[model samples]
Target: MIASTIKTQYEGSSHDSVLYSKPYSKKIDTLNMPKGYQLPKFMQFDGKGNLKQHVTHFIETCNNAGMEEDYLVKKFVRSLKGNAFDWYTNLKPEFINSWDQLEKEFLNCFYSTRRTISMLELTSTKQWKDEPIIDYINRWRSLSLDCKDQLSETSAIDMCVQGMHWGLHYILQGIKPRTFEVLATRSHHIELSIANHGKKEPITDFKKDKVFAPNIDKIGKKPAKEAFTVNTTPIKTSSTPIKIDVIKDSTQIKPSF
Candidate 1:
């Protein structure tokens, strides 16, 4: 009687059978998954071992999503595309056991000790010319991350200051910043100050001098007189005179007679 009563109470639903049987779940319902939490497309790794940055980013994203190891590995596999997907499929047997092992294998395939050395050399020798101080410093910092064992914050600060343009380098040398953060901040402000000063209107009358002014002395001076020759000889007069004396006396005697 008690068994019949219990059976009657649980007969309305399959909940009892579901509790006893482990049914296969073919699909994962991703509806409840966090939005905008998808793995970045650029974060795929082929067999070439050049995806250190991508791997690092993938791990961080998975961690933030609170994924367990099994689910993490599955999600990671699903995220693979193109060459990366092919590589994963070929080695599925080996990496399927553990997420930790998979990560190590992935790194072994892509990350190289020589790459770290190369990054160290670049960071140590790089220089900033016309690039903005902030951009220059950011690039240095990124390269420094790959060679952290070989470089320190203080060393990075010194290298960055040394790589600056001569004008900025000379000014920053006096300040002697001891940390990278402080050095970056001070360099940024110094750059801004230099830019602002360049933009200001230049002094037009700094050294007003009459000597340098346009020569106005010739402006008021009278023009010089032109020289020419004049004729100095006196005008010649006529020198001839007439003689009428004898004929006039003869005519007067005849008139008297």
Candidate 2:
């Protein structure tokens, strides 16, 4: 009666049979662990943080340690703790055959819907009047990580442009979506438009149909002209202009001195 009562307390559960219900297939079970192999403690998942990040960390650790394929399926469970360990303990015995199957199960059990990126947040994003186009695009890129739908570069750029003012929107709408230089060049145009949006812009007062050359500020205000000292001694002069005689074949100026 006592045995039956004890069975009733934990009945219909794997906890009643053993501490853990391993799910390794026959091939995985027959593979012997390498001599002096140690359980890795470099990282552990507690079923609370990002599941994808945990999986990535686990894979990276396995690669760096040169762990064999069978060792990977067998040794990964040792890194779990608390809730993660509890989940592992309940896995069906003699069922898991590969690392991929175990990882898929782990994610299915712990993946949180709250962590999903909101489409509303990505779609409703608006660039502030003074915010830079690069900053706006970068913001979109950053948010794409958590967005529920995986956003493509073209879709991201289109969404970001929708929030921008017409000045930048026009230039960026159909141009190179991922080019940082193009975004930078248009950012100035957006900010300038925003800066001058509501006020009367200052006019240069230039008349139409007349071209005016730019005036250089460094030009002197007046010519440096001064009266020169003339030679007071006068020599006798011929009324006719003096002429120089030259040989037809010679083409050189003769010095009068």
Clashes of each: 1, 2
TM-score between candidate 2 and the true structure: 0.49
| Displacement of the residue 211 alpha carbon in candidate 1, Å | 29
The numbered model that scores best in TM-score is: 2
Kindly list the per-residue Cα lDDT of model 2 for residues 1-257, writing each as its tens digit. 88877877757446566655567888887787666666566588888878888888888777667676666888778778989987887788878888888888889999754455698987888888767767776776677778878876666767767877685666555454465455665565545544554354432211132333445388657755544433333333565343344433344534231
Candidate 1 — what's its lDDT? 0.59
State, as a TM-score between 0 and 1, how close model 1 is to the true structure.
Answer: 0.45
Candidate 1, superposed: residue stretches over 4 Å from native: 1-50, 92-95, 111-114, 117-139, 148-152, 176-257
lDDT of 1 by residue, 84-189 (tens): 6756655733334556766776666555433464544754555556689888888777777666367666766777777788867887877778887787877876
Candidate models: Cα lDDT each: 0.59, 0.68
